[model samples]
Target chain A: MDKLNEILLNYADVDEIPDSASFRKDLGLSSFDTACLITEIRTVMGISLEPADFIKCKTVGALKDYLNTK
Target chain B: MIEKILPDGSKVTAFPISIPQQFMFFMSAQYGAKYPVNNIGLCCFIHGGADLEILRDALYEAISRCDTMRLRFTPDEKYKILQYITPETEMNIDIIDMSDIPLEEAKLKLQSISREDIPTYNCEIHKISLIRFKGNTDGIFMRLHHFAMDAYSTGVFLRDASEIYLHKTKGTAYPKPMRPYLPVLLQELQYINSPQQTEDKDYWFRSLSEADEPVFTDYMLDNRLTQQQKKNPSQRFADIHSGSPEAGTLIFSMSEDESKRILSVCEEKQLSVCAFLSMGLRTALSVFNNNETDVSFKMIVNRRGTVAEKKSGGIRINYFPMRSIIPGDMKFADAVNEISLIQNDIYGHCSLSFWDMLIERHKSMPSDAKPDSTYDSIGLSYQPPTEHIQLGSSPDEVIWFNNGASMIPLYLTIKHRTTDGGFDFIFEYRKDPDPVYDLNIFFTKLRGALLAGAEDPDITAHVLLKQLKITDEERKGKNNG
Candidate 1:
């Protein structure tokens, strides 16, 4: 599975991720949750981001690509 | 009636104490009224489903049980409860058609109730207004006497009424009040002359003495209404301009990737998300004020840890003013680390009252340190999301009451896990009496500063502003050129 699918399956409770599944709206992720997640991904995938960097990453797929580079 | 425990230790029912004493002795001897001391009530937005008759019935029931609701008091020491007063309670109910009434109209209607001319002990009840929308609903507005209750206590009363309504609708047994109002008043008076009274007085004296000269923030905004001025209810809601410069809640959403990044940062810094953000806020606010010497803000300790206190719950909070005094030569990270040290000591020495500390210091100082108002603003840890309790339905969609009173300049409320990784803040200010639009400007600068710091941990206020390009173009050109 790709990083995005892996994140969804491992962390989220839902089956079959929808296109509209926003980190805040669908996953019930708060600002803190987003921060922790970004920090974890940075360590797990060897990438780094600024605290406000998540403000730019809106979705799972989008986040996966951003992480792929760093 | 004064519950006097005499010299022999026997008690006597003495004559009523004066109204001010009633305020001083019964409620907290401290001015418990929300400052800008108008009518005492806060957040008085009414909801639909409230019938005028039902609300009236609740008020009548409350008045019938607590006759002091109608009894007016003179401020004199003779402690006279005057009998010749007119109806001390007043109410206004406006039936606002749902579609025609906008949110600002509703908010303005609620904001218009004033307490400038009200007697210290008399009741002021604005009529419950009705606003009808697609759903079958109504709204109520209230301006109760501050002497009678605080906002938290009033919320309890409203909750009781709501429960009563639900019970009556479903034909359930109506619960009785735990104790009568007058009996409670009498019980409270017993402590007035007790040995603990000295401690209480010392507490007040300390609080006043510690705050040498109160700092007032002037938010520039006009909120005064002309004698003949009419409110255009159709316009946008008027903002409460604060005269005080203060910082409030900072809210923003983060993405999954961003969340992970924040966690890594927290791990690297060995700080919770809240602590990290708080450090950032401290750094930013400290830099913005150009006061690189010291930055101070209060940290709230929620004492609701034990179950017994939770059962007969009262707001048991003691504020610790955490001060970060940076050395003349130190980096931002070093300043934050020092702030963390202050927080540790604050939590350790938290036993002493900030009020008492002031009193101890005041004993050595000369008089004339008192101010009309104290500290301009307070910093609060936000109400936790897990503990968020909605009393009933959210406030109804329409509001209309007609005494325009102003709130104190800067009242701040914050919610977040200080030990963990989340923070949200809310700031309330008086839009009308403000001389500078400080709150808005503060929030704007804060967001800029925090984000700038987040990008680079070593970022200073000057660097942050330079990064954001907030400096004058000419200055920038000169520096660049």
Candidate 2:
């Protein structure tokens, strides 16, 4: 699986996430769950994303765009 | 309450006390305000060929013989909890039999049922079902409320129940309630006001200042008391069997030489085996936590008196925290001796309540923090060998509660039965954290520490490196062979 898809899959029990859906709204992720997702993303992408960075990215597409730049 | 004189001519006060109320007060307070509303009842699941009528008749007569069994709670005018003193009475037993249903499946159903429906005041003695295992005679499963009876008392009740059941089967009057826990309860109450109370209070204060409050959270374990909740049975069993690799019992089967070495160390230092073990564990855990400073947790006191006098056996089960400050770099033997002196000086404190300490120091704690932050550690208990007393029936092995993820995070319990030649070391992690991962780490470290202690009684932080010797040997063999 590609990096983004793998990260999304590990983040939720549900199999798929829509491109249009925000991570928090679509996945119903708690703060701890969100942190876990970020930690996994950092490890996989080898990028340092501060906790504050997660605030701007709401949806899968937004997160993907941000990750690609970093 | 009446005044009486002890054999030593010391004045002792006795109470025409409320037995059930006392039971309820202690149990509810001790077990965190959940289950067995009164906190002193049994959840006995008995199975037999006999129908509901036989079970009811047997239970009725059994409760009748035991007057205290019918004792209930009543509040005094002051509303300070008091027991309703009842005249010796025979009460009808409430028995529920689901024998017509399949046995194994019924057990699962009954176990799945929550306490929400059961009457809080009354104890449950469910007639779950009769078991017909291929190899042996039949047996029934039972769960008792801690408030009604402890393990020892429960065993007696079961033994008596069995005797009564057997006699009834052959058509005989049920035997009398053999031994009651009431006297023990009464004796323990005495300590509430005794010199022991002062010591217990002090210990509680110190422990609370150091430890933290119990935080309740969800446990990762999928094992729920619901029929719909299911996991692969084999996997569940495997997890339980492995226990936390680091957490449960760490036994050190001493070679004759090693045993003698330990004895010599204890004798030279005038320490008990239990005291020595406590110091060892503290040192090991301190190192595992990477504690740059020394810390201490509560240790269980059997409350049994010394050999010459029954000083310890007033039926009160008490534990108190005795702290020992370790030099960040102290050797193992020195640390062990430090524990011995601390224990000796504060042995009197064990009888005090750990609750008062937190209340006294509540101001120092963060106002926003919930209770239990005062102490972060729990007591470790050890039960010495005693002649097995045959209670109502032979006692089943006691199981420890899987205190799922916790708020306070860590508790360690060490209990052993000489009769059974078995010992258990339980580490309770605050389940509120990632319980599975925290426990996985905590148990592994604790187990390593305990095993290291066993191999070298005089183990120190410096000597911990020696524990890798086992792996080293394995590796060497692999290379040579």
Please provide TM-scores, in order, for all candidate models, with all chains considered together: 0.47, 0.52
Relative to the true structure, candidate 1 reaches a TM of 0.47
The lDDT values for all models are 0.42, 0.44
Error of 1 at B298 (Å): 6.3
lDDT for model 2 comes to 0.44
Task: Judge candidate 1 against the unseen true structure and give its global Cα lDDT, from 0 to 1.
Answer: 0.42
- Residue B86 miss distance in model 2 (angstroms): 5.6
Q: What local lDDT does model 2 show for residue B196?
A: 59
RMSD, every candidate, angstroms: 15.6, 25.5
Docking class of 2: incorrect
Residue-by-residue lDDT tens digits, candidate 1, B163-198: 465555556556445223444344344545565546
Q: How well does candidate 2 score on lDDT at residue B61?
A: 55
Give the lowest summed-lDDT range of ten residues in model 1 chain B.
B219-228
